[model samples]
Target: MRNRKNIAVKILAVLAFLVFLIINSRSISNPFRTGISGAASLPLKGLNGAMRAVKKIIPFASLREENRLLRERIDLLNRRIEESGTLSAENRRLKDILGFKNAIPFSSIPAEVIGRDPSNWSNSLIINKGSAHGINDNRAVISMKGLVGRTLEVGRTSSKILLITDPNSKAGVIIQRNRQGGILVGRPDGSCKMIYIALDSDVAPGDRVITAGFGSVFPKGILIGEVAAVGKEPGRLYKYAIVRPAQDMTKLEEVLCIR
Candidate 1:
């Protein structure tokens, strides 16, 4: 009896498998078999869904890489633009200096500033052109704005400029307002103190000051600075005032040596 039961169960299992195969074969052959095809391809549908997910991730990865490359390109372009602008500005400044050099009545030698005094109060610089370039002591140096200084010492290939703000330096200057004349003397700090003006002189703020050409060091009509402030202390014979320098010594780069 047990052997007969086991043979019946095996026959049932074989029949069930045969029915499944027949249904799938019919679905494959007939286009109208919708429900049967869906049931048969459940596992394949899951694999298709996984493939679609991978396809979506591909676009996202590609987009991220494109963004990174674009950022790098933008950075490169910005650097190039900055370099071009700097070159253009430098060329303009050099052109202006060349034009000024040509217009000057006195012959001049061009010099590049090589070094600067470490102390802010020193107001002096070293130039690459010196005695070899025909630069001599007491020769004036100038820039686009106006007079800078005079060559204090010269070497074979280098020279030192004694800035107008040196304490030991003095220049004869006149006020452009009323032609009131005074001497501009440097203080320990980097400012010139105007002295020898009459107590009743009419010098006011914002008046332009220029080299008077009396001392014969700096040429006449060279701009020095503007009158910043004026004051009269008790028992003082002359009015004293401070003058701001026209050229900024901190930004000195190129200067002309007046022969």
Candidate 2:
């Protein structure tokens, strides 16, 4: 610091001496004074140009920093908006589930779906509740829309649900309009087939199907699906109706396990 101050003082002294020489040269026609004055003017011009460049660079650096800060603030606001949207959607879903829970008379345990069966032959889901939460085998699983399936292979803290779309699943269901009963079985195409219907029954494409309460597992009045088409099973004496499940099995997220 001391050395820098000394250099600065020396520069000031040189500038003052240059100024004096230039003044004296203008007053008289001395050749040596004029030469010194011309030499000092060159360095002064270069020094002034450097100072102007430094002044420009300082503001430029400050502007760059401000741009960086503004970008960071925009990114932060975007993340917060995304998080708020997610929270609002979750809140709406939970409210619907709560409404469904209150409307039903049966006791239920709410569970979140966590995993799925990876094989192509079987369709199933794993829930986050099991025997520890009073979930057991053959317990009816449902969502707000309709029946999901029945629990199977219940573990202490998790359970696998046999979705109605699995080929091995079976349920007793009846048509809501005509009261016609049939055996609902899963098809390979991710839909249910209500078989063993009387060929003369008034079954149609738009009939609503629901649980018949024929077993101790699934209760009565739980919606199963709607009939999409009706056809006769080849080489059998019964008519089969293609039924689409009330709940979309592909997007199951949360469910209720009936006690």
Candidate 3:
């Protein structure tokens, strides 16, 4: 194949040189010889044009292949960029969790929110740490902001949590300014209410609520929420206050597991 291509190139070069000489001839006096050369050059010129067309085609296919490879490389780089963004976000979240863990004085296990209960989405969640990592049922769960929930079920490396906003969940809390204590219970709508507050109590909205340290389940002074509203009925014996949780339960990502 190499020898054939070399021969074809040499033949074209010779024909092109013959054409040049025939067209620019000044000393040729024979009309027969000049006309014969012109006729021979006609076929050679067409052949040269065909060779140029083929040469153009060869480079075009190569260029297309190079363009295809470049496009693939760009796509790979784009995918890597997306993955880098995701990892950066994860690193930031992990740093926040670490800072929160360091700030707390008590012993706790840091766990990542892995999943949630689909059947009762508002009530429960799953964490990455479980019985194997010293996490078990009824252990208190909290976030950097405040109390999240308590451990419900435990596995070897995973566990489910009962959110504080769940209607069935309950905690004992107290007003920070005053010693007024009450039962913080969850509502169906995912908010908590402090019950058994006295009507004449000096309680107001925005009062900070924290764990009373009286219960065996949750320890001393973990923040629960802030008072959103105080409710009073004319005939009611006790005034109840609506408590807004410190933690955003809907966005649970990392939490502290206190035994």
Candidate 4:
């Protein structure tokens, strides 16, 4: 502290300042005090004015520089917040799939939906795992709730999913109560129907529908939907049942592909 004080004292010159203070010591509230103060600050004011004149050519020097730095910081923080939220959501989804994975019997792989076809958003989506992970065409894709879709195309690192909500989707399903079988097909407005049930069958509303394991696609006994309505196709002998699929296909994020 002594050394720093000595250095500070040595760097300051008090000759003129001492003279002004001595002259003002006996003058209380005098105009000379203000005049002397203004006179003493003339050099500093001139220097500041000169710097501002130079800054006029430079166009916003210190303030613009500080604002630029602040903007950069804000952008970086926004990106970090976005990345953090995304990671948290992904972590939660992985945990859910981990729990579901433990309860299933078939060999399966978990994947994320990374892309979608806007023209057919509800019908198809792209997953992050593919042929490299043993995913192939016609492999069933399921969510924690129930069936999600089936793999329609596969790549080395990604695959396309054909959601059962698509109009082209078809799977053999059976009414859980009485084992009445039919094909589940999608519609334009994104609903499904179980076709080919006999009109005389004992099917009713609220009966569960499940996969029949009849085709090479989905395996047997997965809850597909609950029967919402039962009716006959006009002039057709076999009836059709409106089925509400268990999975909310519009909001899929992660799914499992069964091998």
Top-scoring candidate (lDDT)? 2
Candidate 4 residue pairs that clash: none
Clash count for candidate 2 is 0
Model 1 poorest 10 in a row by lDDT:
31-40
Candidate 1 lDDT over 64-140, as tens digits, reads 55567578777566556655775687789899889999998878988877666657667777777756678887878
So what's the TM-score on candidate 2? 0.70
**Superposed model 3: Cα runs more than 4 Å off:** 1-86, 120-122, 233-235
Give a tens-digit lDDT track for model 2, residues 57-137.
665565555557578776566556655765697789999999899889899999877666779889888777767789978
Prediction RMSDs, each to the true structure: 36.2, 34.6, 34.7, 33.2
* Model 3 vs. true fold: TM: 0.65
lDDT of 3 by residue, 119-226 (tens): 653588767676779986787898989999898756666677888888878888899989798889887677899998977788899999998878777887999989
Show how many residue pairs clash in every candidate, following the order shown: 0, 0, 0, 0
Q: What overall lDDT, based on C-alpha atoms, would model 2 receive against the true structure?
A: 0.83
lDDT of 4 by residue, 1-259 (tens): 9999987786565666777777876665334433433343345445545764674534334445545657777756655665577569768878889988888888899987665556843577777776778887788989898887798657666677888878889998898889999999987566789999988899898999989999998999888878889898789989999988888877776889999
Residue 23, model 1: lDDT of: 80
Query: Ten residues in a row with the worst lDDT in model 3?
Result: 29-38
